[model samples]
Target: MIFSAGDGKESEPSTPLPPPYSGHNHVGDIEFHEILAGTDNFDESLVIGRGGFGKVYKGCINHGENLVVSAIKRLDPESSQGASEFWSEVQMLSRLRHCNIVSLIGYCTHEQEKILVYEYMPNGTLSDHLHKQGTPLSWFRRLNICIGAGLGLRYLHNDVGIDSGVIHRDFKSSNILLNESWESKISDFGLSKTCPTNQLSTHVNTLVKGTFGYLDPNYFRTGKLTRKSDVYAFGVVLLEVLCGKPALEELVDGEWRNLATWAQDSIKEGNLKNIIDSDIMGEISPKCLRKFVKMTERCLHDNTEQRPTMDAVVVTLKSVLALQEKLSMQAAGSRTIFGRMVDLLPFPTNGENSGRVEHNTLAPSKHGDGIVVAVKMLTSKTRQAYDKRQTKHIAELAHPNINIGGIFECRDSKHKYFNQLLFPNRGNFAEPLSWGTRLMIMIGVARGLTYLHLNKVHCDIRPSNILLDEEFNAKLEGITKTVTKETHISTWVRETMYYMAPEYFWNGDLSMKSDIYSFGVVLLESMTGRKAWVYGHIEKASLVDWASTVKSRIIYLKEIMDPRLNHNYPLQGAFECFDLVLRCIANESKDRPSSKEVLQTLERIYALNK
Candidate 1:
């Protein structure tokens, strides 16, 4: 029995079901009236969700001998979704059947009322669980959810028997629903379309309509949709899960930034640790993290052909989950010091200070107990000298920028070592630094140098000697030489050549101004994201020379600025900082500013920007 499409009341139809919905079960008009209590009168207490289509109500009904709960989506008569969308959803859900796809229990069309019923998902939408400040999901749970969504897409694109494969045009976190047991299922097919199966054509040219942040840039630009379009949206969801942030965020300065753009840049610049969610820190394995990020990067590639298929994505996720499981099991059996188990993962190669630094974990103890620290092993050749210098320096000097790794003495061995607290969520200066962070680091380094120059001189100054704490505060490390009436030129020239001043490189001239020259080189590297000496590109090509070539023309600053920043820095501060860097790197030792002057300039620039 069917109801007429005109009036708001229900009436039995004498005709057969239409050909478009021929084989599907059409609920009787009288049965729907009883389930909904009456015509167009829904209880506000039962309203579960509201969308562009209309309001969704939770209701229980009798299916055969069992009581079944269902989500009934009732479309408003004045909504943009009219008869076309109602019929489209009915056809789509009825035809597609998979474990990962939301199940369609039944539908109702009584007079002017259009409603669709789905199996009630007790846990609500994936968006609610992820961004609503609820209980945070574990890394493994989030990975499983993404795998389930990928499987659903694989079935729609490849497993379905229809000549035209299904493409979920609006695939975002909100469209993913979670069940009572936390199983994920894809829902909402209002904007989905079937790709033409013709052998000659590769895509379907159509009008583009989707959520703004998740829309594929290519599809939005060309109005040509492909299966990869859905892949692009799924990439955004992957980032959301990893970072626990929205697809777009408005900054305090009233700028709306895209998550995908920021994430891609961060990853490219080896700054993934900076953008990852803090909750998942130290929980994710390094190998798994790298693989997961690489997969998401591939999915977000601008070239459609470069993006991997949904089947490939599912396989990669399964592998990542397996690695995470193995690491968890290993951690369970790992050795614990104090009360925390130590992760056996080695430190990244780029952040090592000498060949001795290794990542180690230490458990928290009482209120003033120590935290996880990285152990640095000293070689026999340098052990005596390092011990003498560190013992004197650690006892005499105490500053926020100085690296004071506490000494650890082992009873069984004849060697004593130093351990520094580790920053698990930050990479070394080899990775890119935000403009603000660069300024803060430069100031900290200058202050540390100022303290050293007042008593002793720092013979070695480079990016590798500067360590950043978890808060991105710079700490100065390595050896310092005593300044006496007699200058030691040979010892200073033996250090890293790239950062040494020209006067020291030409002849052995060791002074405080020489340290200022090295600081200038580091400042330039921080700003341009380039090394002091660029090899292979040109013979004996120095970063100072490159900058000086373009320094005269201020318009060329755009080419030299760190690309990872994406031009999201303060322009006035950048120009001011560049001018300071130039003064510090001047050829003549007398031409450069003193360490104190450099510190004051950086402080002023930071203040003006703030």
Candidate 2:
């Protein structure tokens, strides 16, 4: 009665049905003609789910003497998910049976036709309910659904009674289905794989295949598949449920960002209330919210070994649910004061104003350990724009040289603000800097820019955007703007023309190289201690043009050095650094050195001089 997809070499012949279903039953084989009739010629009206694999159709089937509803999935022959994937699902679902796991009714294979049938889920997918359908789910409902899904995963990884564990390679909200009673069931086992049973090996090395935002970074990088991969994806789903946001969001500003990055940043800064779905805000107890956030953080640990098991996740979720239930029973008058603390913050006056930057001190140790932090309120308009601009780029661009900031929500105006580490002597670059200190700052800036470019395309690079700490270490702070490969330079060049490349100015093309051009201007300004543009006899003069003219005469390079240095600079390093600045500002965008190359050259110069 058991069916095998047949190891990609050949399709196994259809097997006969097992004796009347007890608890676990082999997947039944139905005729393709019957499947076609049930689906009504694969009509669009019957289609319920469409994906890369194919279309899922709602259909009716005869089980025993009674008619039953079922979901019929028809494979697209042209899809990359071929016979191997189709069979994989059939084999996996046949042996797995649980209340929270989708049930397989039967399958049909005739000639080239490959189809699967499953118990019909009347309410559709969790993704549909959470995002598409206007009916917002209550906090209680979301928590219950997550708990059920977690239990199902726990069974897959531990209680399945199988020596080799199951790893749901593609676990996300969309793969979770809801029956008529709104009971959650984990579905779509096509990408599921069995982990190694050997005691010595912890994971199975395999090809990396999963959704973009939900893919585990460790798995994606190392190609090691384990149960923890599912944990990472489930963590993303947890964030989606908590925030009521998509796993991957394309903001109004045209940048694609991950919700996990946004959630991590918000939680770290104790601004968890800001990112929560407005509908569920104040409904969750602060204690429960903190536990939920902590669970997500544990699940998303960069190291797979450090991530919690599905069993651990289920226990934590139950604890949170219990806390929520307890808080729900308490009278409003008797509710804990800590739960209402976030609501008592001052109203935010900074709404959509880019020019104004306000600093405030938050209450001590609300979420993280007791350490006072500084908060900078950004306008709601800015938050809306920033949310769309791939906040993950900022989160992932963590380095000693990068001024990474946390995000939070303002209680009064419901505006979101960034919480940055406080440093004394915060000011513009116009302040005096020694030649050695300037070189160190330039190198730091190059390293930070290099990291950003490796992870994302940062189009904004300028001296004003660079902040110096007490020790004069440069920390970059600016919007990490990302543009598509097809994005034209002219789209954003108008707003930042001073540091933009000449090619971008003329042809309207943008790339990572564009940032190098801007970096050149920053380097020139930092060297000469002058503004991007200065007044001359005729009109305004560009820093790039001035630097290029000075470089033409090697001797004038020293004269162009910042007057504040007072001829106390290292001559060899100064000349080499200026040479790099000239290369970065090349008129032909392609002629510019890459950020990595700039970092390497700067490091070599610094080492040689030191």
Candidate 3:
């Protein structure tokens, strides 16, 4: 994937270059059309940074007497990979909008050159304070940076104000820039992916793509990028903030490794005194250091499921900040280090018990309107069973399209026995759904699953598990409870087998690609109105086989559509969805596109029609 002219490793371009191309690197197969024609506004002094992609320059956009400064990201034209990077950024950023994310103001594509314009950050990136020479950032300032970055990421993952979920594949200190007053903004999205909203398509076969140092190790090995992977990268950044060192750096042994493992090893060997940055050595108390280390360790854990979600991380960091503030306030009058330590114990909240789960509902209304919120009821055994997992996963998972209402924890005698409580009904769906409602059910199912897939959180997708609300927003049920040890591994295996790719089922490995396989089977069920696996069928038929048999019988997409709708689905959109389903079910997992890519395809189709 690396192409360089200096090393004599470059390939010839497809088209002839314009004059004055000397010393400029040529992109092998990429081209651009300049949107800002006859403009000479780029400033050389504003050049901020450089990378394999290209240089980032500060620029100004003029309108009459008013001026607006912005960051102009231009392709080096000679980077060889610059063209791909340019288009990739445009393709991803154009569809995203969030408070924490930097805005792509505009772009210029002309004469085979690509340039992206963004709002400028006067304070520069976190890399400046942490690594590059600058006025040293205070510990509180660093904590704020982590909080802002987490909020931006959370917005990308859950804020449905945009078209789909966004996963910033390259998340790191360098990618996080600070503006005036040090507010952090996530700056890049070229390698991001959005899951397809419509399940009936072929976009799930695309191959995995991302950066090296920040890349999720599991994803790098398995080609399955999940939200946990992003958590892993964020964990590395958190460790950097704590240890005051890069995630991967050269050590005394002359080898490169992540600081998380190195710091953990130090802590294990009783050498914590050696790892902390000397600048903040005496200033930071053991209580603060312990909580910070514990939080970072949870993030760096090997199991993706074990890593806290961005929401949870944000909450944990805030709690840490609160504890830090309390200690700082108490330390103002302390005479000795031991006295400070005695007063540094974690102060319990004033409440008799932590907050309990509560439920709310939007009165039943039109299609997609009425939603029954799952409140974690303290008195309910079902809610107690659901509390085994952390609350961070549930509270942070809200979107106009995502179905998790609200999840809370309480310590009351009635509620203390339960671990977690879910909204509305917990895994019960005997109520008969109307034909008209089923179509909405299909769409809701697509939206929620698409969110999970794109965000890299794969729910155990199944028919009996898919719940429907009054508005028929398909909710992925059965996750509120804790899994027993004996059934855990086998359940995951069986779930994988139900919709697993042939190669994976034969070999018995769980992967993100396996989710794509499951999605394809789920799409088949949505289209044909059949379960993936039947309990008592004499033939022991699989959903995939039934879908193939009826593929030819599908004269019109509605003909094979879920009868719950009575075949009154939207004609073209439904058909297009069916086509996507066909592609998703393509025998090879390699043929499936990543959820982000699929989401883009669906957006294109939705745009064309809407």
lDDT of 2 by residue, 373-399 (tens): 223323343334445344564457668
Overall lDDT per candidate, in order of appearance: 0.69, 0.70, 0.56
Measured by TM-score, the strongest candidate is 1
Ranking of all predicted structures according to TM-score, beginning with the best and ending with the worst: 1, 2, 3
Worst 10 residues of 3 by lDDT: 415-424
Per-residue alpha-carbon lDDT of model 3 for 1-610, expressed as tens digits?
A: 2211122223323353332212122212212322232124444566787787687877566423545676767777776555545556665666556667787666666665667777788888887778779667777788888999999887766563434566666788888989898889998776665543222121221234554456666666555556666777888888778667876776577988767677779666544544555445445544566677777888878877788878898998888777667666544422211111111112212212223321221111111122212232322323334343435445545544444522222112222100011111456453434333434554555566566654444435555455543334456543432222112221222233456555443333445566566666766665565656433232234566656666867565555666655655456766676677777767666787666555555554454445
Residue runs of model 1 more than 4 Å from their true location after superposition: 1-19, 22-30, 38-41, 196-201, 337-610
Error of 1 at 502 (Å): 29
What's the ranking of the predictions by lDDT, best on top?
Answer: 2, 1, 3
Residues 1-610, candidate 1: write the lDDT tens digits. 0011223222323332442454234432225665576323588888888877788888876655666787888889877665755666667777787889998766777777778778899888878777785668888889999999999988877765557778888888888888888888999886677775443136766656678778888887777778899999899999999988778877777998788998899666534555666556546765577689889999999988899889899999999999788766644433223311111112122222223222233222221223334333233443445455555665565677765433221223222111122111345443445677778888999998888777766756887677665566777765433543243322211125667676664345678998999999888888887767554331235677778777776555688887877996788888888898889888888999999999999999888767
TM-score of 1: 0.55
User: Compared to the true structure, candidate 3 yields what TM-score?
Assistant: 0.47
Residue 111 alpha-carbon offset, candidate 2, angstroms: 2.5
lDDT (Cα, 0-100) at 116 in candidate 3: 74
Per-residue lDDT of 504 in model 2: 53
